[model samples]
Structure formats: C-alpha cells, structure tokens
Target chain A: MLAFIIRRLLQSMIVMFFVAMVAFLMFNYVGDPVHQMVGIDTSFKDREVLRESLGLNDPVPLQFVRFITNAAKFEFGISYQHKRSVTGLFKERLPATLELSFVAAFLSLVVGVPMGVYAGIKPDGWLSKIFMTFSLVGVSLPTFLIGILLIYIFAVTLGWLPSYGRGDVVNWGWWSTGITTWSGLKALIMPAITLGLFQLTLIMRLVRSEMLEVLRTDYIKFARARGLSDRAIYFGHALKNTLVPVITITGLQIGSIIAFAIITETVFQWPGMGLLFLQAIHNVDIPIMAAYLMLVAFFFVVINLIVDILYYVVDPRLRLDLGKANGA
Target chain B: MNKPLLSVENLRIEFPTRRGTLVAVDDISFTIDPGEILGVVGESGAGKSLTGQSIIGLLEPPGRIASGSIKLNDRRLDNLPYAQMKKIRGKEIGMIFQDPLTSLNPLYTIGRQLTETIQTHTDMTGKQAKKHAISLLEEVGIPAAAKRIDHYPYQFSGGMRQRVVIALALCVNPKLIIADEPTTALDVSIQAQIITLLKKLCADHGTAVILITHDMGVIAETADRVAVMYAGRLVEIGKVRQVVKEATHPYTKGLMSAIPSLTHRMEELTQIDGTMPRLSDIPKGCSFHPRCPECMDVCKEKQPELIDIGPTQVACWSYHDRQI
Candidate 1:
C-alpha cells in the first residue's frame, strides 16, 4: 500500500512537471511577455530593466528553470496589477477557493449519490424517473445559469438569502474577518449550490450507471440469495462494489470542479483564486498568472495521486502482487 | 415420497418483446425428493439456467414465470410475496452460478460473506458465525481455514472460489441447492474435484441439488437422474446411467453421440445439424424439430407431449411405441 502511494505520488510529480512546462511555454508563446510588461511608450532603458527584472533576458529553458526554482522556493515575484507578492495573493485567495470546492464536492456526493442509488434501485418508479429527469436538467443547465436561477429563487423571489458576494465585507488582508454569521452562510448558499450542481450531475450519473451495472453482477444475486434484506443488499454489498469507480471518477473530477469554480466564483463575485485568476488574465499579470496556473496544476496532480492511492485502499487486490510483479 | 422437497409443475417463463411474448421455459415439470441430486443438462439457450433461476425467484426483468406452481414441501413458492420469497431463497434453496469469480462479492472477505449469510437466516451471534465460517472453509478443503477466511474472492483459485460458493450455499443448511454450471468455469482436472466436493457435501447434508450444465460427463459422475432440455423444453429425463446408455429421445441420443469418445472412431463425428432456434424463432410445433436428425413430417406440425417410456419420460414421437 505504501509502495502504491509512493508510486502514485511520483507519477503525480511527473505529470505536474509536464503541465507546468507546457503552461509556462504556452503563456510565453501566446504573446511577448516583455512587450506586455513594458507599455508601448516605454524607453529602451526601461524595457531592458523590466526584461532583466523579470529574467525574460534568459533563454527559454533557463527561464523555465528559473520559474520552476522560484516557484519551488515560494518566490513568484510581484503581481503587476495588485502590486503585491504573487505568492501572497495566491495564499490569500487559495483558501476560499479550496473551501468552496471542498464544500461543493461534499454537497454533490451527499446529494447526488443517494439520489442515484435510489434511482438505480427504483428505476421504473415515479421518484426514480423524476430524479433521473432532474439529473438530466442538472447536467444540461450550465453552472452560470444554475447560479442565476438559484440567485433568483433564493435571493430575489424568496428573499431568504443574500444574492451575491462572499459575505457583508471583502476581507483581503492577513486574516479573513467576515463570513462568520448565518446570513453569511445564506450569502454563500447560492454560489455553493451553483458550484455543486455541475458536480452533482457528474457524480449522479456515475453512481447511477455504475450502480445499475453492479446490480446486475452475480455477487449481488449471491447476496440476494443469501436472503439479506433489501437495505443490506442494496447498500451493503452493491454500494460498496460500486464505490471503487465512483470514488475514482469523483476524485478525478475535483479538477473539473476547481475549473468550474472559475465561472462560479466570477458569477457570484466570490473572493477566491478563480476571480483573482480572471483579473490577472485581463490585466496581463504574468507573476500572478504563473503562480495561479502552477498551483492549479499542482492541485490537479495531487488530487489524482490521492485517487490512485485510494484505489488500493478500496480494493486491496491492487496493493498485492498477483504472482508476477512487473519490473521486480 | 410423502412430500417432495420441491415440486415444480407446468412451469412456464415468457419474455415480452415488441413482436410478441417469447417463451423461454415452456411447460417444464420436475420434482426433487429429499437428498436427490437431479441434473438438468442442455445446450446454451435451452432454458436450464432459467428454470433454476426461476425456482429461486432470481429471474430478472422481461423473463418471468408466466404460469407455474412451485411447491416447497407442499407450500406454494411461486405466489409468495417478495419479502417472504426472499426468506425462502437462501434459507430453503441456495444457488451457485457458473462463474465463481462473479458469484462472490469481490470487496468483501469470504468470512464476512459467509457470516453475513449465516446471521441473516440464523440466530447465530457474530462469534459463533465466525467459528462456523472457519469450519465451513475447512470443510470445503481450503488450506489455512483459520487465516484464509479473511481472503477476498479473487485471492482464491477458481476451484477454491467454487468451494467457497458451495460453503456459502451450505451456510444456511438449505434444503435444496441449485448449482448452475458450478464446475463449468474450472479446468477439466479441477472440475472433477469441485463436482466430487459438491456431491459429497450435498450428500453429507442430505441437501437436494439441481446441477444445471451441458456436460454429460459431469452428469454421469454426479447426477443420480438427468433431465435433457432442448429449445426451452424438457425432452428426456431419467436415471443417469440409463439415459447415457439407452437415450429414448432422438435429441438425447444426438447429444450423447456428440460427446467425444476415446474408443469410437468415425471420419466425421455426428454433430447436431442445426443451431438451437433463437427464443424468438422457436418452431411452431416441436421446438427441436428443426435440429433433430430424425425429424418426421408430423414432428413439424404436432408437439409431442412427455410420455413415459418405462422408467424414463421422453417427449419424442419416435418413442411413442415399440420399434416396428
């Protein structure tokens, strides 16, 4: 198991390196970073100083080396727009995005899995058909649209929650001071639901289809022949076997959820890395963009590694040597 | 003789299709006395597995028992509510499918599966169930019974997994164990071992068995009585030895000749000429007439009713009377 985890982590590092290299090159190749850095009216001396300052004077490989080394050391330079350390801006913004994605993923699974399970068990029943139809709507409807719909329902019509913003105030300092009250939770409700809806469709469809396949497996029939109660058969044996793939898919989709938050956060104006990323992109802030891009790539790699490791935990056969160990 | 362990009569299974209702199991009837091992053999799509699954009420959608009376020791089993039928499934009649790898849950330990079955049907405590499971593992010839009970289904070899399945089937001491091609998945050598083990175990427990397979060799070695099916209907049924030597039905004779023999040498082995008709295209009269080498003019227009030929029951017009 430890070996499996270590191997997965190592594989993750390789993937991260490839993603970083590609993204860095793509960011550089898209346009002249130096030109963007120094405005059109800049002097030769200013352009040279800015180029030297940002280390754009170096070759592509050397620039990548410098970027990687500085990234590793948490020295992402200063954001041109924010006029602050790029790392500091990321550190401040990372938590809110993480918090939002985590809650959204949780809510997706909590709501979607049970609904999927219920649908699988009762495929022909009215409730199951209704849930399945509802899931289709969830899948087809965009996150931004869901956000708008939720805001309209819960914020405009019902008057039950705040429509936008993270909370009453935008706390962008050393520590977050707001977003502590019930109304704050109310304000978060729309964005969270919007974030969760997309993930919900993914998880729901995965669970439902996987569960339907599992229900047809002979083991479930064996469990049924054992005279286990319907609850035990459905949840105990069937659900556990279905979870291996469901978990892997859900885990891999965390990257997608994070990606979705870019739109979700933008829609609700939540103070997260997603909004920060949008601002950074529009203003051509290289330091902030590089830092955010690398961080997102890092997260994608880590979450996948975690999922790969979890495969061993969920099914022990993956951990054991099935006689012939490859490259032993 | 007073009350048979199970008596299934006029059992029929029909699947609804866009065209019409397709008969999967057509008017099959059989009975198992206490401690009797009745083997049901047929080629694929002959409805052997369907009959067994239907008896256990495990037949999935589209295929259902259209009209039948399944009596377990004189109690009607077919009409019972699902909740009550579930109780009777494993407690009264356990089942083992063809694939051992698939028959047991991959995620759960053998011990947990066994104990769960035991606890579900019996009043055994967890500790007692564990002890029983360990004993069952040993009884099934698994090595390291005490330690190996924690192993998952994939950890064991094919034969060992079949044994585990048998052990699970025996956990509740069910009166009838329906083993559907239990040895089919094992290698030829392991097949005998599993067959021997299942027959011995069932005999020891006096649990009646319905061993469904197409292998005549398995039937010859394990089954006391064999029922031969063709195109979803029983064509021949009798004592195994008698059926092997003197098959009254032409289809049964065709099947027997098709089984490769070490001594018999022929330039072209006698093969059943046609494929078993698809469920949708069953012949109007005798379902096997299209494939029967001895098919007669009347065989195409009239379905033969099962008639007693001495001790055996055969449904063939050729056996309607003594040879001219």
Candidate 2:
C-alpha cells in the first residue's frame, strides 16, 4: 500500500511537471510579456530590463527548468500585477474553494444516491420518469444559466436568500467556513446549489444506470429469491454492489465539479480560487495562472490516488487481489 | 391424511412477446408430499426451471402464470401479491438456484447472508442469528465455520458455494425447497456429495424438495418420486425405481435409454430421434410423438393425459388403452 501511494505520488509529480511546463510555454507565447507584466506605460528600457530579469533572454529549456524548480517549492515567482506572492495568493483563496467544493460534493451525494436508487429500482415508474426528466434538464442546462436562475428566484423574487458573495465567514483557525454563520450559509446555498445541481444529476444517472446493471445480475436474482424485503434487497444487496462503481464515477467527476465551480464562483462572486483565476486572466498574471494550472492538475492526481485507495477499502476482493498485483 | 406440502394445479406459464404470448409451461400439474423429493427431469426449455420459479414466485417478468393455482399447505400462492409472496419465499419455501457461482452476493460475508435470511423470516436476534449462521456453515461442510463465516462468497470454491447456498436455503427451515438443477454446475464427484447432503437434509427435517434437473442419474439416486417432462408437459410420473427401471411413456423410455451406463457396452449411445418441439410449434397431439419410436396416428392427433398404468402414470396413447 505504501509503495502504491509512493508510486502514485511519483507519477503525479511527473504529470504536474508537464502541466507546469505547458502553462509556462502557453503563457509565454501569448502576446508580448511587457504589457502584461509592467503595463503599456512602462518605458522601452524598463521592458528590456523586465525581459532580462524574467529570463525571456534565456533558452526556453533553461527557463522551464527554473520555473519547475521554483514551482516544486510552491514559489511561482510573484504576481507581478498585484505585487503579491503567488503562493500566498493561492493559499488565501484555496480555503474558500475547498469549502465550496466540499459542501457541493456533500449535497450532491446526499441528494443523488437515494433518488438514484429509487429511480433505478423503478425505471418505468412515474416518479423515476419525473426524476429522469429533471435530471435531463440538469444535464443539458449550462451552469451559468442555472446560477442566474437561482439568483433570480431566491434573491430577486422570493427575497428569501442572498444572491452573491461569501457572507461573514468564521475563521475556525484551521478552516474558515461560510457555513458557520446563518447569512454565510444562506450566501453559500445559491452558489453551492448551482455548482452541485449538474453533479447531482450526473451522479444520479451514473448510480441509476449502475444500479440497473447490478440489479440485473444473477446475484440480485438470488438475493430476491432469498426472501429479502424490497428495502433490504435494494439498499443492502443491490445498492452495496452498485456503490463501488458509483464511487469511481464520483471520483472521476470531482475534477469536472471543480472546473464548473470556476464559472459558479464568478457568477456568485464567491471570493475563491475561480474568482482569483479570473482576475489573473484579465491582467495576464502568468505566475498566478501557471500556479493555478499546476495546482489543479496536482489536485486531480491526488484525488485519483485517494479514489484508488477508497476502492480497496470498499471491496475486500480488490484488497486481497490488488495486493498481489501491486505487491504491497 | 397429511396435505401435500406444495400443490400446483394446471400451472400454465406464459411470456408476452411482440409475436403474441408464448406458452412456456402448458397446464402442468404436480404435488410434493411432505418430506418428498419430487425430481423433475426434462431437456432444456422443458420448463422444469420455470415450474420451480413459478412455485418460488420468482418467475422472470413478461412471463407469468396464466391459468393455475399453486397452493402451499392449502394457502393459495399462485396469485398472492408480490409483497406477501416475498414474505412467504424464504420463510415457507426455500430456493436454491442453478449456478452457485452467482447465487450469493459477493459483497457480503456468507455468514451475514445466512443470518440476514434467518432474521428476515424468523424472530432471531443478531447474536442468535450469527450463531445459527455459523452452525449452518458448519452443517454445509465449510471448514472452520466461525472463521469462514466472515469470508466473502468468492473465497469459497464452486462446490463449497453451492453448499453455502444449500445452507442459506436451510437457514429459515422452510417446509419446501425449490432447488432448480442444484448439482448441474458441479463436478461428478461433488455432485454425489451434494445430492447425498440434500437427501439427508430432507430426511432429517421433513423438508420437501422439488429437484429440477436434466440428469436422470441424479433423480434415480436422490428423488423419491420422479416426474418426467416433455415440451412443458408431464409425460410420466412414478416411483424413481419404476420410472428408471421400466418407463411406460415413450418419452420417459427414450429418456431412460439415453443415459450412458457402464453396464451397456454399446457401439453408439442411444438417443431420442428428434428434439423437443418449440412452444410455438407444438404438434396437435403429444409433444413427444415426433421423437417417439412408438409414434402412431392417434399419438399425433390428440394430446395424451396422465393415465394409470400399473406402477406408473403414463401420458401416451399407447398406454391410454391399457387398464391398470
């Protein structure tokens, strides 16, 4: 297990390295750096000095090595536009994004799993048809539109909730939470719902289809023959079998959820990494953008590793079998 | 007189299709007295499994009982609501499926499955259920019952898994067990052991069994009474000895002769001339007429009903004229 983790970390490091290199190359080649770094007001001589200092004079290969080494230590130079440590900027914003994503993921699971199970058990039932239709809308409708609609209903019409921004968050020292206060929770609801709605359907559909497949298996028929109650047959026998695949899809989906939260964060003006990245993009803050790219890619690798480990925990067959394959 | 543990009267199973309804089991009827092992023997698609499924109330959808009444201890089971029938399933009639490979849920421990079945039907507490489950595992011959109880279904071999399924069926101590080809997927050696175990369990508990199999040898060894089926109808019903030694119906005789035996050193194995007719294309008369060596014009013109013929009930025009 330790070897497996170590191997995953090594692979992730290689992937992150490539991601960092790509980000560095992509940003460097997009228009002149002088306007982005020092603004158009800077003198021609100043731009020359900036170019030299920034290693534009060095070979592309040498420049990539420097960027990689600095990135390895979480130092992505500095946000030239803001005159702030890019790492510090990322740190300040990460907690908010983490809090948002976690809540959204939690909400998605809580709603999706049970509903999906119900729909799967009765695919032709009216309730399931309704769920499928609703799920279709959730799948097809864009995230930004959902976000706007949520605001229009709750904030503008119903006037029951706040439309935007993280409201009065309490810093619990280790983790700041918008959920800690009422208004903060209220502020969180719209954006979190907007972010989670699509994932809810994705998970629902995944779980529903997986549950359907599992339901059709021979073991399920035997389970039914065992005189298990509809509830036990479903939740105990079939649903437990369905969980392994559902969790895998959920793990793969976490990346997309985080990706969608970028738009959601912009819509709600939730002061998180997405909002920070947006500002960085407008100013062409190459350091911040590069840092964001490497970090997000790293998150994907780490999350995948966690999901792999989770597969072991959920299934004993995999534990005993994968032990031999992984030699750990 | 003691009531038959299970009784099915004119049990006709049908499957609705785009082409119209297909009759799978056509007006088949049988009874299982308490502690009796009624061996149902037939070729593939002879509806042996379908009859068992109908009894167990687990027939696949699109297929349902069209005209029949299944009574367990005089309680009508044919048209009981699904929820009520589900309640009756593990409690009243245990079921063992064909392939033990996929019978037990791989996710759960064998012990948990056994205990869950026990709890589902009986009023056993968790600890008592666990104890009983371990005992069941031991009874089924799983070594180190206590330790093996916590093991998943995959850990056990195929024979061992079938044994576990038997134990699982025995958990609630139902009056009847519908074991559809329980030994079909087993090795020849292991098959003997399982049959022996089943026979012993029935003798001990007075649990009636409807053992559905294509193997005549299994029926001869394990079954007290044998019902030979052809094209969804019972062609003969008699004592195992009578049916195996001297079958009256042409289909039963053909079935008996087809079994390869060490005593017979024949150059070519005896085989029935033709296949069982498809449900849609069942001939006007007896389904076995096309395949029977004794096929007559009367056999091809009218279906035969089970008629008394000495030690056996034979459904053939050839025997219909014979007095007991």
Candidate 3:
C-alpha cells in the first residue's frame, strides 16, 4: 500500500512540474519584460542597468531556473506596476477569490445533487421536466450575462446591494453577526450567485447521468431484491456509487471557477485575484503574472491530487485491484 | 395437513408497450403446503424471477400485476399496501437473491445488516440484536462469527456472503423463505455447500422454500415438488421424483431430455427444436406447442388448460383426456 501511494505521489509531482513549467513559459515568453521594466521613457544606460538587474542578460533556461528556485522560497520579485512584493500582492487578493469559489461550490452541491437525484429517480415526472428545462437555460446562458442580469436586478433596479468593491472588512471579521453582515456577505451575494448558476447546472447534469447509471447497476437490483426501501436503494446504494465521478467533475469545476472568476470579478468590480490578474496583464507585470498563473496551475494540480486520493478511498476496487490490467 | 403456506391463483403480470400490452407472466397458479420446497425451473426470460419478485412486491417499473391473488397462510397478500408488504418481507417471508456478493449492502457490516433486520421486525434491543446476529452467522457456518460480524460485506468470500444472506433470511424465523437461484452465483463446489446449507437450515426450522432456478439438477436434488414454467405459464407440476423420473407434458419431457446426464448420451442432447418464445410473441394455443416435439394440430388451435392426471398436473392437450 505504501509503495503504491508513493508511486502515485511521485507521478503526481511529475505532472505538477509540467503544469508549472507551461504556465511559467506562457507569461514569460508572451512579451518583453525588459521594455516594461525600464518603462517607455528610459535612457539607454537605465535600460541596460534594468535589463542586467532583472536578469534579462541571462539565458532563458537560467532565467526559468532562477524563477523556479525563487518560487520554491515564495520570493517572487516585486511587481513593476504596483511596486508591491509579488507574495504580498497575491496574498491580498487570493482570499476573496477563494471565498467566492468555495461558497459558490458549496451552494451548487447543496442544491444540484438533490435536484439531480430527484429528477433521475423520476425522469418522466413534471418536476423532472421542469428541472431539466431550467438546467438547459442555465447551461446555455453565459456567466457574464447572468452576472449583468443579477447586477441590474439587485443593484440598479432594487438598490438592495452595492455594485462593487470589498465592503467594511474591520466590522466584518470571521466571527461577525452571521452571513448577513452589511458589508462582506452583502457584497459577495450577486457575484457568488452568478458564478454558482452555471456550475449548478453542470453539477446537476453530471450527477443525474451518473446516478442514473448507478441506479441501473446489478448491485442496486440486488439491494431492491433484499427488501430495502426505495429510500435505501436510492440514497444508500445508488448515491455512493455515483460519487466517484461527481468528485472528479467537482474537482475540475474548481479549476474552471478560478479561471472564470476573472470575468465575474470584472463584472462586479470586486477586488480579487481575477482583478489582479487583469491588472498584471495590462501593465505586463511579469513577476505577478507568472506568480498568478503558477498559483492557478498549482490549485488545479492539488485539487486533482485530492480527487485522486478520494477516488481510491471511496472505491475499494481502485485500492485493492490496481495491479491488474485495466478492463471492464 | 396444516394450511398451505402460500397460494397464488390466476396470477398474471403485464407490461404496457408501444406495441400494446405484453403478458410477462400469464395466468399461473400453484400452492405450497407447510415445509414444502417447491422448485420453480425455467430458462431465462421464462418469468421465474418475476414470479419470486412479485410475491415479495418488488417487481420493477413498467410491469404490473394485471390480475391475481396471493395468499400467505390464507391471508390475502396481492393488494396489501407498501407498509404491510414491508412488514411481511423480512418478518414473514425472507428473500435470498441470486448473487450473494451484491445482495448485501457494501457500506454496512454484516452484523449491522442482520441486527437491523432483527430490530426492525422483533422486539430486540441493540445489544441483544447484535448477540443474535453473531449467533445466526455462526449457525450459517461462518467462522469467527463473533469478530466477523463487524466486517463489511466486501471482506467475505462469495460462499461466505451467501451464508450471511441465508443467516439474514433465517434471522426472522420466517415461515417461507424465497431462495431465488441462491447457489447460481457460486462456484460448483461452493454451490453444493450452499444447497446443502439451505436444505439443512430450512429443514431444521420447518420453513418452506420456493427455490427458483434454471438448473434441473438442483431441483432433482433439493425439491419435494417441482413446477415447470414455459413462456410465463406452468407447463407441469408434480412431485420431484415423478417429474424428473417420468414427465407428462411435452415441454417437461423436452426439459428432462435436455439435461445432459450419465445415462443420456446422444449425438446431440434432444434440445427443444426452437427458442423459448418471448412473452410478447407467445403463440395463440399452448405457449410451448411451437417448440414441443409431440405437438398436434389441436395443440396449436386451443390453449391447454392444466388438468390433474394421477398425482401430477399437466398442461397439454395430449393429457387433457385424463380425469382428475
């Protein structure tokens, strides 16, 4: 068991390395860093000095090695646009994006799974037809459009929430009154809902399909034959069998959430890593952009790793029977 | 003799389809006296499993009992509500399915499943239920029952899992146990063990069984009375010895000749000429007439009603002249 896990972990590290390398190369090679670092109005001597200091004089391989080694110590160089430490810039913006994604995902699972199970169990019922119709609409509409609609309804028309920015953080610490604090939560609602809508549809569709398949498995029939209640056949037998794929889809969804939050943050004028990512791109802030890209890739790799481990834990066939040739 | 344990009269199941309604199980009727093992033998798509499932009120969707009456110890069972059916399921009539590996829930320990059934039907506390579960597991010949009760279903082998299922069926002291192809999913050697275990356990407790299978060898070895089903109807019903030794109906005769045995060695085992007709494609007269070797013109024109002949009931025009 230990050997198997160790081998899997080593493979994971190799995959993560390739992911980090690609993300690093994309931002680094996309544009000239020296011109941006020295600015548009720098003298030849100043440009030369900036180039030397920023390691533009070094080879690309050496530069990547330096970047990677510095990243290992979390000492990404200062952002030219903000004049802030790369770590500090990311630290300030990371929490809002994380919080938004977490809440959106939580809401999606809480709503989507039950809806999917209900619809799958009664595919021909009126409730199922309604849910499927809603899901189709939800899937077809873009998040940006949904975000704008939410802004129009809640902000412009109703005047129920603020249009942008992080609200009073001092009055709304971790242990504030509740989720209904005037500042932080009230500000988070619109963007979270907009982001959660599409994810909810994806989750619901995948869950419905997976649960339908599991419900048709031999084991479920066996459960029914054993005189188990309908509730037991559903939640007890079908639900657990469906969770493996659900976990994978959910993990992949987390990656997309961070990727798509860029638009959502732009729409709501929310201060998050998405906003920072846009700023880094506009000003050609290489260190910050590289750092941000690496961070996103890191999240993708880490989430996938956690999902893989969970798959092993949830299914014994994956754990005990890995040595056999993969087949049905 | 005491009252019959179970009685079914004119039981029929139908499915609504685009091509009109399909009769899955036609008007089939039979009765099991107390402590009788009635072996139901038929090929796949013969509606054998459906018969077992219908008795327990677990038929899947799209199928409905079109008309029938099921009586358990003279009590009407066909129209009882779900709650009452549940009350009878594990308490009065225990069920053992085909595959033991999938029959038990993987998430729960065997002990928990057994104890849950006990606690659901009987007036036993958690501790007492646990004790009884372990003892029941031991009675089913599971080794280290005291410790193994806490182990999940996946931990046990195929044979052991079937034993656990048997133990669960026996836990309630049910009057009739439905062992639906109980040993069909195990290895040949393990199959004997399970068959022996089932016969011995049911005998000890005076519990009747309805053993449904496609294997005639098992019926010959285990059953007291055997019912032969074809297309969805009972083709013949008689004592196991009489039916296996001397079958009356042509379908039963074909089934008997088809079983490859030491004494029956021919160029090809005398297989029934054609496939078993699908429930949707059953012919007008006798469902088996198209496939029977001794089919007559009258057999294709009129359906044969089951008639008593000596100690056997044969549903064929050839034997219809015999009086009850």
How many angstroms is residue B311 displaced in model 1 relative to the true structure, after the best TM-score fit? Answer: 1.9
The TM-score of predicted model 1 comes to 0.91
Docking class of 2: medium
Looking at candidate 2 chain B, the ten consecutive residues that score lowest on lDDT are B315-324
The worst-scoring run of ten residues by lDDT in candidate 1 chain A lies at A319-328
Q: A1-328, model 1: which lDDT tens digit per residue?
A: 5555666678877887886787677557767766765568999898888878877777889888877787779788877787788888877777678777887898999999999898888778999888878888998998889888888888899988877776753455655523565666676777878888877877888888888999999899888887889988899988887888888888877887886689999888888999999998898877777777778888888888777767767786765662235433
Q: Can you give the lDDT of residue B96 in candidate 1?
A: 92
For residue B10, what is the lDDT in candidate 1?
Answer: 94
lDDT of the structure predicted as candidate 1? 0.85
List residue ranges in candidate 3 displaced over 4 A. Answer: A1-9, A23-28, A59-62, A171-180, A322-328, B263-268
Say which candidate scores most in DockQ. 2
lDDT of each: 0.85, 0.87, 0.84
Q: How large is the C-alpha RMSD of every model relative to the true structure? A: 3.3, 2.5, 3.1
All candidates: TM-score: 0.91, 0.93, 0.93
Residue A318 C-alpha lDDT in model 1: 69
> Which CAPRI category fits model 1?
medium
Candidate 1 residue-wise lDDT at B172: 79
Position A95, candidate 1: lDDT: 67
True contacts kept of 2: 0.72
Against the true two-chain complex, what DockQ does each candidate achieve? 0.69, 0.74, 0.38
